[model samples]
Target: MKKIKVGIIFGGKSAEHEVSLQSAKNIVDAIDKDKYEVTLIGIDKQGSWHLNDQSSYLLNAENPKLIQLNKSNDNVAIIPGSENNQMIHASNGTGLDKLDVVFPIVHGTLGEDGSLQGMLRLANIPFVGPSVLSSAICMDKDIAKRLLQSAGIHVAKGLVYTSANKGTISYEKAAAKLGTPMFIKPANQGSSVGVSKVKTKKEFEQALALAFDYDNKVVVEESIIGREIECAVLGNENPKASLPGEILPQTEFYSYESKYIDEKGAELAIPADLPEDTTKQIQQVAIAAFETLQCEGLARVDFFLTEDGKIYVNEVNTLPGFTKISMYPKLWEISGLSYSDLISELLDLAMKRFEKNNRLKNTVWDD
Candidate 1:
C-alpha cells in the first residue's frame, strides 16, 4: 500500500499566527509516518504562501522543534476541482506531488474561517476539519452562539456592534445594555486574541478599540462566573465527545498569553473533576454545539458552569488549538486516543468526506 501524501498547512495572516505554527508542528510531529508522507506548506504572518524547505518559517517561539520536508525544489499550485484533481507545479519547474490529503493545522482568519477550506474545496483535495459554511459560521462568536441557542443550547447573552457604530454607542449606554465584567472579543479571531474583560465604562472603550483591531464586528457578553470547561468533539455526523477538561487561567481569563505563552499559566484538568451528570450534560451540549454550527471533522466546545451550576455554551472552535498542551488534543488523549492516532482519524475522516462529496453532481446541462 502506498503511503498517502499529506500536505500539513500551517501559519497564516491572523492574530493566532504564532499559535498556528505550534499546531502545525504538533501535527507534523505526531502524524504517523507509516501511513502518511508529510509535506509542509507554511503561510507567513503576512499571508505569503511558501513551500517548506530550509526556511526558518517553520521555527517559532512556541514550536522550536523543526522538521523540513524535502520539497526544496518547487513552488506548487493547487488546481481546482474534484476527481483526483490537483496540479502541483514544481519550483524546479519539474514534477508534482499529488496530495492525497491536506491536514490544515492553522487557526483563525484565513486558516480556520473557511477561506482555506474554500480553496481546498476548489482544489478538490481532502482536508481535515469543517466545511466552508460551518467554518465560517463557527469562526464568528456571535453567529456560533446564535446557532447554539437556536438549537436549544444555553448560551450567554451578548450584543454585537461594529466599528461603524463608533459614536453611536456611548460607553455608558453600552454598559447599560449589557452589564459590566463582560467579555469583549472580536467576532472573527480565535486563541483569545483581542479579547478583553471590560468591567467599567472606561475599560469598555479601550477594549472595543482593541477588539476592532482584529475584526470589524465586536461581541460583548455578560461574564458568566464559574468553572471554564472545554470538551473536544470529533468525527463527522455522529461525533463523539472527549472527557471534559477544566481551564485554570493564570490571569483574569484565558487570554492569549495563558493560552500559548507562560509555561505555568493555565492548569488543565483532564477528565475534569465534575459530577457524572454534569459530565454527561457537558458532552451532550458539546456535541449539540458542534452539530448546531454544521461542523464536520472536529471542534472544541467551551462552556462556563456558573456558581449556581448553570451551564452556558461559550463558543465552539471549528479548528481548535492542536498544540500538545491544548485541550483539544489532551482531552482525546485522556479519552483513550493517542495524538498519533488522532491525526490518523482526522485524515481518515477527510478522505471519507471527500469520497462522499464526490457523489454529488455539481452542474447540470440545460440546453
Candidate 2:
C-alpha cells in the first residue's frame, strides 16, 4: 500500500506562532508513520516558509532538548495550480516533496483567517479545516457573532469599534451600553490573542488600544457570568459533536498566556458536569453552529453556560489547538476518538470534500 504524502503545515506569521509550532509538533508525533509520509513546512514569524526535517519539526520550547530548523537548503516555496503542487527548496529549486493533502495547524491571522485557505484553494490542494469563507467569517469576531445570531444562535450582545470610530467612541459610552467588566479583543485574532477583560472605563480604553494594535477592528461584548464550556465538532456535512467540556481557568479569563505559555493555567473538565438536557442542548447547538457557518472538517464551538442554565454561543474556532493538552482533541479523546484517529478522520474528510468539490462544474463550458 502506498503511503499518503501529507504536508504538515505549521507555524506562520501570527501572534499564535509558538502555539502553532506546539500543535504541529504534537500532530507530527501522533500521526501514523506506516500510513502517511509526513513533510514538514514551517513558516516563521518573518513569514518565510522553510522545509523542516522530522526531528526539528517535532521540537518545541517545552522540549528541553530543542532542535532548530535545518537551514542548509531550507527556504521553501509552493507554485499555485493543480499540476504544480510540489513544495520546492528555494535554493536549487529542487522538489523537496509534493503533498497529497495538507494538515494546516497554523492558528491565528494569516494562517487561519482564510489567507492560507485561499492559497490552498488556488493551489488546488485538499487541506483540513473549514472552507475559505467560513475561515474568514470565523476569524472576524464581530462578523461571526452576527452570522451566528442570524442563524438563530445566541451570542453575547456586542459593539464593533474600528479605527474610524476612535475619536467618536468613548469608553464610558461603551461601558454604559455593554456594562462594566466587558471583554475586548481583536476582531481578527485567535488563541485569546489581544483579548482583555475590561472592568472599568480606564481599562476599557487601554484594552481597546491594545486590541486595535492587533487589528483595525475590535469587539467589546457584555460580560456573561457563566461556565466556559466547549464542544468539539467534526465532519463536513452531518457533523458530530463530542461530549462538552468546561474550562476552569486560573486567571481572570482564558488569556493567551493561560492557554499556551503556562502549563497549569487552566483545567478542562471533559464531559462537563451538567444536566443531561443541558448537555444535549450544547451538543445540538454545536452541530447547528458548525453547519450554519458552513464549516467543513472540524471546529471547536465555545459557549457560556449560566448558573440558571442559559447558554450563549461564545465563538467557533475553525482550527482549534491540537497539542497534547489542547481541548479540541482532548474532548474527542474522552468521547472515544483517539488523537491519531481524529487526525486520520480530518485528513479523510479533506480528501472527501476535495473530491466532491472537483466533481462540480468549474466553468459554464461543462454545461
Candidate 3:
C-alpha cells in the first residue's frame, strides 16, 4: 500500500512559536512512519517558510524556552489552484511532491486565526482542525464567549476592549462590573500566551498593557472560582467527547510558564473525580460547544465547574497542544486512543472532509 504523504506545518510568527516547535517534534517522532510519509515545514518568527530536514528541523528541541525553527535554504511557497496540491521552491519554482494532507500545529495569530487555513483551502489541500470561519471564531475569545452565551451556554461575564476604548474602562469600572481578580487576555491568542490574573488596580493596568501588546483587542473576564475542567472532542459531524480532566495549577493560575516552560507548574487529573451525572453533562456540553462553533476534526473544550455544580463554557481550542504532556492527547490516551492512532484519525477526518467538499457542485453549468 502507498504511504500517505503528510505535511506537518509548525512554527509561526506568534508568541506560541516555541510551543508549536515542541508539538511538531512530538508529532514527527510519534507518527506512524510505515503508514505515512512526513514532511517538515517550519515557519520562522519572521514568517519565512522552509522545507526543513526532519532530523534538524528544530533547534534545542528539548528546551522549551530555547526551541526555535532551524532555517534551511529550501524556502517554499504553496501553489494555489495546483491540481497536484504541491508546494514549490520559492527561488526556482520547483514543485515538491504533493502532500496527501497537512497536520498544522501552528498555535496562535496567523497560524490559528484562519490565515493559514484560508491559504490551505485556496491551495486545495486537506488540513487538520477547524474550517477557516471556525478557526477565526475560536481564536477570538470575545466573539467565542458571546456566541456560546447566545447558544444558552454559560460563559464568564466580561467586556471586550480595543485601543479606541481602552482608556474608557478603568480598573475601578471593571472591578465594579466584574469584581476583583479578573482574568485579562489577548482576544486572539492561545496557550495563555498573554493571559494574566489581576486583583489590584496596578496589576490590572499592567495586564491590560501586556495583553494589548499581543493583540489590538483584549478580553477582561470575571475569574470563576471553580475547578478548571477540560474535555477533548473528536470527529466531524458526529463528534465524541473524552472523559473530562481537571487542572491543578501550582501557580495562582495556569500561566504560559506553567503550561510549557515549567514542567512542575501544574498537575493534571485525568478522568476528573466528578459525579456520573456531572461527567455526562460536561461531555454533552463539550460536544455542544464543538458543534456550536462549527468545529470539525477536533477541539478541546474548557469549562469552569463550580462547587455548586454550575458549568461555564470557557473556550474551545480548535487545534489544542499535542505534546506528550498536553491534556488533549492525554485525555484521549486515557479514554482508549493511543497517540499514534489519534494522529491517524485526525488525518483521516481531514481527508474525509476534503472529499465531501470537493463533491459539492462549484458551478451551475456541468463540466
Candidate 4:
C-alpha cells in the first residue's frame, strides 16, 4: 500500500504563529512514519511559504527555547488555478507533488479565519478542521456567541464594537449593560491573543484599544465567575466528545502566556472533578456546539462551570493546540486515544470527507 502524503502547514501571519509552530512540531513527531510521508510546510511571519527539510526545521523546533523557522529554503506557493492542490517552488514555477490532504495547524487570523480554508476549497483539497463558513463563524467571537445563543446554548451577554464603524456605544453604556468585570478580546483571534479581563471601568479603554489593534472588531462579554472546563470533540457528523478537563490557570485567566510561554502557568486536571451528570452535560453541549458550527475533524469546546453548576459555552477552537501538554489531546488521552492514534484518525477523517464530497453529483443528468 502507498503511504499517504500529508502536508502539515504551520506558522502564519497570526499572533498564534508560535503556537502553530509548536503544534506542527508535535504533530510531525507523533505521526506514524510508516503510514504517512510528512511534508513540513512553513508559513513565515511575513506570509511566505517554504518547503523546509523536515529534519532541519521540525527537529530544531523541538527545542522550545530555540524554535524558529529556518529562512533559507525553497520558497513555495499554492497556485490558485491548478488542477491539483499543492505547494510549488515559487521561483522556478515547478509544482510540489500533490498532497493527499492538508493538516493545517495554523491557529488564528488568516490561517483559521476561513481565508486558508477558502483557498483549500478552491483547490479541492480536504483539510482538517471545519468548513469555510464554519471556520469564519467560529473564529469570530461575536459571531460564534450569537450563533450559540440562537442554538439555545448558554453564552455570556456581550456587545460587538467595530472600529471601522466608529461605533457609538460608549464604554460606560457597555459596562452598564454587560456589567463590570468584563472580558474584552479581538473578535477574530485565538489563543487569547488580544484578550483582557477588565476588572474596572478605568481599564476598559485600554483593553478596547489593545483588542482593536489585532482586529477591527471587539467582543466584550460579562465575565463569568467559574472554573475553566474544556471538552474535546472529534469527527465530522457523528462526533464524540472526550472527557472534560479543567484548566487551573495560575494567572487570573488563561491568557496567551498561560497557554504556551510559561511551563507552570496552568494546571490541567483530566476528567475534572465534577459530578457525573455535569461531566455528561458538558460533553453533550460540546458535541452540540461542534455540530452546530459544522466543525470537522476536531475542536476544543471551552465552557465556564459556575459555582451554581451552570455551564456557559465560552468558545470553540476549530483547530486547538497539539502540544505535548495541550488540553485537547490530553483530554482525549485520558479518554483512551493516544497522540499518534489521534493524528491518524484526523487524517483518515480528512480523506473520508474528501471522498464523500467528491461522490456528490454536481451536474444535472438526463434520465
Better of 2 and 3 by TM-score: 3
lDDT string for model 4 (239-303, tens) is: 99999999999997898888887878898889899999999999999998998888888999999
List CA RMSD, all candidates. 2.8, 1.9, 0.8, 1.7
Write model 1 residue lDDT over 1-367, tens digit each, in one string. 7899998888777877777777887787788888888877877666656677523445334432342222233456666773554755544544357789898878899889999999999988889999999999999898888878888889888889887876676777667877778888999999899999988877988998999988999988887878999999999978999999999887788888887766577888888999999999999988888888898999999999987778898889988887767889999999999999999999999999999999987689745
Number of the top-ranking candidate, with TM-score as the measure? 3
Q: How do the residues 82-169 of candidate 3 rate in per-residue lDDT, one tens digit apiece?
A: 9873699899998999999999999999988899999999999999999899999999999998889889999999989998889896
Q: RMSD of model 2, in Å?
A: 1.9
TM-score, structure 2 vs. true: 0.96
lDDT of 1 at 12: 76
- lDDT (tens digit, per residue) of candidate 2 on 1-367: 9999999888888888878888887898899999999988888778889787876554444652242333324888877774664666787876765688999989999988999999888888899999899999988889988989998999999988899877787777888888888999899999888899978778887888899999999888999999999999999877999999999998889977777667688887887998899999999999999988889999999999988988899999999998777899999999999999999999999999999999998687753
Give the Å error, residue 31, model 3.
0.4
Tell me which residue pairs clash in candidate 1. 74-91, 75-91
lDDT of 2 at 124: 82
Better of 1 and 3 by lDDT: 3
Least accurate 10 contiguous residues by lDDT in model 4: 57-66
